[model samples]
Target: MGKFDDLPETRRKGLEKMEEVYGFDMSDGEGDFFRYTADHLFADIWNRPGLSNRDRRLFLIGMLVGQRANDVLGIQVPAALKNGELDEDALRELVILACHYDGWPNGSRMNAVVEDAIGKAKRAAGS
Candidate 1:
């Protein structure tokens, strides 16, 4: 059976949505981990109890910042915007916070990905 054969339609769509935000597309042929991460990361881990989606996005952004994962943080900027948990201001704050912990090198280009996100947001908001 395919890795995603057992997933619900909504769950599959969530992964597809996130993948699109991440500049990826999916296929049953992708790989077990890819399918699994899509289901778990977007549909499971992101949908679990307690926190709102925005709250979760914030935490995720902060986690990337703390770990010096500027690249992931950059991609996440658009994802967070899609999830409605962030705006340019919030993303900038996350990068600023990272500078104190992870240093400026990573924090610097953080805006590159984030800028893309901001531009997308502006486009989406019709600014």
Candidate 2:
């Protein structure tokens, strides 16, 4: 069986969700990093039973903010909207909450990334 074939149902779903969010493609021959991300990070970690997808998304947002991972958030914020994990208002609240923990500079950086992501999503949506 292939690696994909060996995936648990939840892991397969997690991989699908990851692709929807990040446009993550395994067929691009990107490298080991992408493979590991798809197989291990999304499959193994994200698929872990206990947390719902919504709970995972919330945790992701917090970790991204704490890490100042604005580039990752560029994809995540839009995904949150598309996946119905977060609406615009919830996104705004996330920024506000992030500011309290991450401070102004990082928060502003996150805001900029969110704005850029929102613009990208809007254009994709024909607005």
Candidate 3:
């Protein structure tokens, strides 16, 4: 199989979605990791059958909150809202739930990122 031949059209669609949703650019860098990100992470894993993209975003948000991955959340949180996978209230509730599990600090920091993401999403939406 070629670079994305394992999943073929699915891989292409996944790449397009990644670009559309996250503005990811695998070809911009010089690393096998980017290729793997495109061919496997986005193509294979993201296209997997069970969860919808909305579910994936929710899981990602929780994981990011738990891990305090503010940088990734800066991208994903807005994408979630922009793509209609999440709304403001639901995002707040999810962060609150994560706070219960991860502790107050994580929730607090993630909430900042959430606010920033929501602001950017709104600006992009021109509202």
lDDT of 1 by residue, 18-118 (tens): 66545455654357777677666766776678987667667777777667686677677787776666767877787787777777887776767787888
The candidate, 2 or 3, that scores higher on lDDT is 3
Candidate 2 — worst ten consecutive residues by lDDT sum? Answer: 21-30
RMSD of 2: 3.9
Worst 10 residues of 3 by lDDT: 21-30
Where does the lowest 10-residue lDDT sum fall in candidate 1? Answer: 20-29
Candidate 2 residue runs with Cα over 4 Å from true position: 1-17, 20-31
List candidate 3 segments past 4 Å from native: 1-11, 23-30
- Local error of candidate 2 at 103, Å? 0.6
Candidate 3's TM-score reads 0.80
TM-score of each: 0.66, 0.75, 0.80
